[model samples]
Target: MSMTPPPGWYRDPSYPLVERWWDGTAWTDHRRQPEAPQLPLTQPESPGGGGSGRAKAVALSVAGVVLVASIVTGAVLLRRDDGSGDAAATTTETTTETTTATTAVSPSASDTPSPSASTSAPSPDDPSVVVDELNGITLPLLDGWVRPQYVAEHDIVMTTPGTYDCPGDPGLCRHGRVISRTVTANDEKSPKALAQQDIEDAANSSYDRDLIDNRPFKGITSHQEVKSGQVAVAGRAGYFVRWKVKTRVGPGGYVESLAFPSSVGSESLVIVRFAFDAGSDGPPLTDMDRITKGIRPVGDADTGGGVGSSIGPSK
Candidate 1:
């Protein structure tokens, strides 16, 4: 007759490192690391020394044999429970192992990443786009244009790469340039009035004198209105004024001031200034219209339009 062990935790037959719970006759899902087995302390030898020691030794040996027998009986019972042959036994073992692995905590899952952590806004320095965070707008970069490395008072500026000696000054100058900024100083609210007021200053700055008091275009001898009208810019109603200015030296240039209500913060008025050389080397006059149309809300998709040929660095 086989002896059945009482319900308790015992060292697992297959997994030596862990203990599994046995419920009188069968193993349970509960498992834990095996606790160290404790040995009873030996009593001090009495006057009958060797005999007492020998009896104690025999008792311990018998107890150890009983433990081994109980484990062997449990193993046999487990196999009989399966009823099938070696294949069923193997499947049982595999399932137990898989359950153990599934319950274990994985190191990687401890630190979960946030969904928004991987997202980021478009860079303002991107070669093909110019982001103006202040006024919440973006200007498309044309083939012959680039974001200026140094921007003075403008919120955003783009210009032809490289520069040439000014006709009337010792300073360097670009043939094509565009700048955008909010109109904070002026109290003018009407787009038409703002555009009309800014055009003369735009021409004077482009053809009269630069920041350093250098006259790149010598001086504006005269200027004639080439285009003036209400226009739509970046989905906003706006107005623009273009002028053909004659300079004291070189083939002069065209200047334009476009004023529009910004789509962002406070809906502030914004002014975009444009200056382009009049000769064949300058950016196309049509590019002015293209750029104005290309302006969009900061996050809008880019609308492609610009000069196809890149302007090389001045020799």
Candidate 2:
């Protein structure tokens, strides 16, 4: 802020006089000082030309002090941010002084975290659970079971595996799985259709007795529609029914009747019927009581009955 003008000219003090210029550092363009009227060491020119006595020196002194103070303040600010602070930090908007002052901390590789652990599935105690709506009960079914085959849709037929010629009369079997098994006629589709088809499928395929409708396949024994209702899977709607009962297969005997309502629901009233052919291995009474155990329907129906269809005969 000092305003010392470059040596140029100074107002001369003589009457009607003008100015004197300077060279390098000495007064130049000098007029000889009147030896008689000596030039005062320095003259305060009257209002017309000379400058002030002490004012100029004071101004220059103040400017020098201000410049020195600025330099010192800048240095301290920089040092404080650099690493002089307990927890020094710096950001983009920070003053340049602060940036020059601090440094970011970095950790060794060992200090970094290891990879995260992988997740696992539930154990037996945890019990993998799946909810299914059967009857009015929304319950869980066993998680894993070996299912030979299953389809969103299919037909059921019943027949006992019985053979005409064999050491043990290797029983014939109901051909439960087949296109011919596709549910057709309402008469052809009830639980009876299942029973009949089983016997037929078994006889036709294995026993060489195709379409043996001689004796109506032992009628499917239905207890009472234990529970029946409309159900849907992915929007496919059908009626579901469950029941248990006993029925006679041939002229001599009867077998246990379990309500095997696998097709609880379908497009129509799903009538689940389980019946064993009287002639099956066990005693007549035991045959009828077998329903207590799982009926084990092979095809559409358990072939223990004497039904037969193109699918196969029930075993």
Candidate 3:
């Protein structure tokens, strides 16, 4: 006969990075990062006591085995005296108790999400809000904006629904877009320096060309600074740089790069990029300020109070 493993967390067969929980009968949705294995510590024997210690250990092992066997035999005899059906019921009850105790005492019990939490967890695709869990921030879903169905790796994006043909390429493009992601591959931590440096790239990507060198706005010919200054975002001091770029085809667009320390998770630097079509069809310029003001820490309710402010050009 086969025996089922007790309810516990075990290495996930599909995902090596995390462990999955088995609830006696089946795997649960619960998973967590694997913890480092701990090595057992051994107590060293005193000088000139190795032989005596070994002898005592052997004796103790033998005694433990004998004690266990005696207990097993007594249990079997008692069960035999009880009806077989009663014995089976008792075994089932004992197994259930063991499973509960094991789960309650698990080292990862504190880390596991409760059933309520699992059900109530926020989604990135929330219609009225974009939850960027990776950066621990939330952006408001203003009118005409929706979460992107597919975002680039490491990016959380919200864009205007529907698309229009690119001026220079056969690909489609949106009138407005915003992307949030943690800053990486750079050592600079100053918000102003990072924002200023990233704005050019942001403008280039939004107006000049895409990853495949597709010039969505037919390539930016020149850009004029619209705003570059210190700002407060999600209650954190940050910086932003915005520019209006002239393109060879279609109406040129406005782009901005904002940098700040994330409100959560080691306070890593985060960058938010914005691109909007530069015409009556695009989102209003004031909406940029409204969206910036609407940003808040994850789980924070929209108090409707403007928390972000542009303090003018950085010295």
Candidate 4:
């Protein structure tokens, strides 16, 4: 039986000029020319039949140079045969280090973004004034009007001094009282219905009766009259009426009511009342027109015209 040499570089059986690598039991593709062995140090023969020290030193130097050259060539062959394995391993280690660093810096699940620092400005359509602490409705601030006060039940009042507060010289009363009220509407409400309600409400008011009963002169007769029509108040088409009561003291300052009927949840009536002395220096009818036109629901901009601007509800 023939025994095989251990796995290593050996002279090729087929090619005489190169050696091939044997892996344990099999021949591998790796092949290279065998590295030449370095010459052994051989001293020169002197006349005495033995080399002198100088000659031995020179031979040893030459042998050392050849040995270094052989070692360099063998190292090159070893590295060439190793192929891309080393570079691939180095690249894999570098990739692993980069991956570890990235994972360490990544944000965790508990991280949260910081909140913004600035406050926002007010919106143009937002309401500046709120009315009725209970049944709150909001609107923009009205020019030329004082702060509103919740006075009577279901009523919020605001007024211009020159109108509601006549210049003291007037013997009777003043006007320009802009009163707002939210009232429940009857099922058959229309522009005419608003006018009728205004007439009834004014005729029953104590203020109207007192003005009629307390006559500055005894001969004057007192009577209640309501003049109503479809007037556009605050760009809204609704029933507007002027309630006038003539007394001995002259025509009692008229009570003007402008009704804006629209649905808000289940409630459907928004009434604005204007009371001013007809004889005293009071607010003009135009002022009443402006107030009604400017009115808008909370957070809603004026949509060109107000409630029922084109036509009244179909009767």
Candidate 5:
């Protein structure tokens, strides 16, 4: 029986130090340095059997040999503790060669996409307003912000200049600036678990820093009454995080994310994020708050307002 990990990037169990893509079915050629930008899946055509089966076979074979070699090397070291140093050295060399040969056939982590490879310059066809069809919400034109027509190799949309243009780190770019697809939760999952998974996915790709350094604010809710200048997510209660990441431009790289359950205890999730350069004159937290607060399901309205409606902002 095959036990594949759920769809996401995880530390390659076989490779140990590197991360590999698990497209919910099998490992893919896509890999990266831990906490780096996640590369898109590049699956090659197989001769007859399935690609996943072949990958698993190769990985298992390599793992078995490596394990056996490690045991043998350990035993040799124990027995040679009081013996000649020359014998110990020879045994070590042989074991090292065996391990190297076993791993040489696998894909190199360097083949992963670069940060530059994952970004693109804005183009024409960008509309005056940004609409998220999935969530039935729309964003009117904000000054100095352009809707990206093409964000190469990433699922995230860049709503602002600093959102995905990390000269220092490229793999963390997000291009699908308007909306994200709905993430349906399984029966066993909770809303918080779903939110944490979203964060983990980001951390897995281009988020290699400590959570403490990110300075994430905890216990966020999606209440419309929270405050005037904070994120007001629609639907159910949600999770919020503010990341103060360092980039080449300055230490002003900021990422604010809002995630909420589509409804009370429902298995559906709705998440929104805002990335910007906060060096000195970065976008205010109120703006970030307004952006999220303005999101609402189509035809969904609050007592006083709705998304892109009469209450949030005057257009």
Candidate 6:
């Protein structure tokens, strides 16, 4: 005769100390729960008749993830910006034909445009001024200085004879070369008047326009003024009228400039510009004074019909 278990008790008397009884369909109720816990109900190996092969696949996936993470970590260390020097250095022997000259002004002075008494000008549309005549360009303005060498390049507008280098280097491989082009009084309006307008116009006229409008040209960060001739270089007294304008250049790439032309001459306008990137290296203005003061125009002026020497312009 089979003995039926008690209503709440299904005793496994194999090692009977206290019995684990059934609570309805399962052994949930116990006289005293054991300290050495039993294996859980959800620990079934595989319901679909499989080994731990499924677990092995998951392990392999985790391993693959760790391997990929390792590879990325190695590459990142090699490509970091910390002390990588710029990409511009390695490929071209650190020499560029269109390098810029950069430096600073002295404590006794600054590159800043100082307040000065204004110089009055003739009317913009005065009949006495003939616009197009190459001869229309004032002559006496460059009387003492030599002729500026005209080179048809984008980075150069009109440079007196001198050497130009990039931001920090002593002298970029190119030496004894200067570039310039014909400037019109039509754009300038006042053929005789030497002002920042003529300098800005010269900057925006040719390939250098993209160099400037697209960038500070020197990579400066924060600016307080525009580029006017305030910072006077030795043997060349001048100022850099600073213009902090919002240009179409990329973000934080504003423009700053300073120019110094001989007081009265054909090559009387020298312009210096800086294009600043907020996140990059500091600007090249630290050694700019030596480079700018180094600019020297060669040859006498091609003054037109005695109009420039005696008076400013024909008009």
lDDT of 1 by residue, 137-207 (tens): 77777889876532222233677765665677544467788877777767788888998877777777677
Q: Model 3 off-target regions past 4 Å?
A: 1-127, 150-156, 302-315
After superposition, the stretches of candidate 1 with alpha carbons farther than 4 Å from their true spots are 1-127, 150-156, 302-315
Better of 5 and 6 by lDDT: 5
Q: Per-residue lDDT for 188-208 in model 6, tens only?
A: 322223334433332232112
Q: Over the stretch 141-178, how does candidate 2's per-residue lDDT look in tens digits? A: 12221111111111112222221211111112221111
How many clashing pairs does model 6 include?
48
**Candidate 3, residue 314: how far the Cα is off, in Å:** 8.5
Candidate 2 overall lDDT versus native: 0.23
- Note the Cα lDDT for every prediction shown: 0.57, 0.23, 0.56, 0.39, 0.36, 0.27
| Superposed Cα deviation of residue 184, candidate 1 (Å) | 0.7
TM-score of each: 0.55, 0.19, 0.57, 0.44, 0.40, 0.27
Q: Write the per-residue lDDT of candidate 4 for residues 70-179, one digit (tens) a residue.
A: 34434543442331111122100100000000111122222221211111222455434434322223333456555332111113245543212112111122244555
The root-mean-square deviation over C-alpha atoms between each candidate and the true structure, in angstroms, is: 33.9, 46.3, 23.9, 45.5, 17.2, 31.3
Q: List model 3 lDDT by residue over 218-288, tens digit each.
A: 66777889887788888777888888877878788888888888878779888888888888878887777
Q: What TM-score should be assigned to candidate 4?
A: 0.44
State in Å the error of residue 305, model 4.
3.1
lDDT of 6 at 57: 26
Pairwise TM-score winner, candidates 4 and 6: 4
Between candidates 2 and 3, the lDDT winner? 3
Q: Which of candidates 2 and 4 reaches a greater TM-score? A: 4
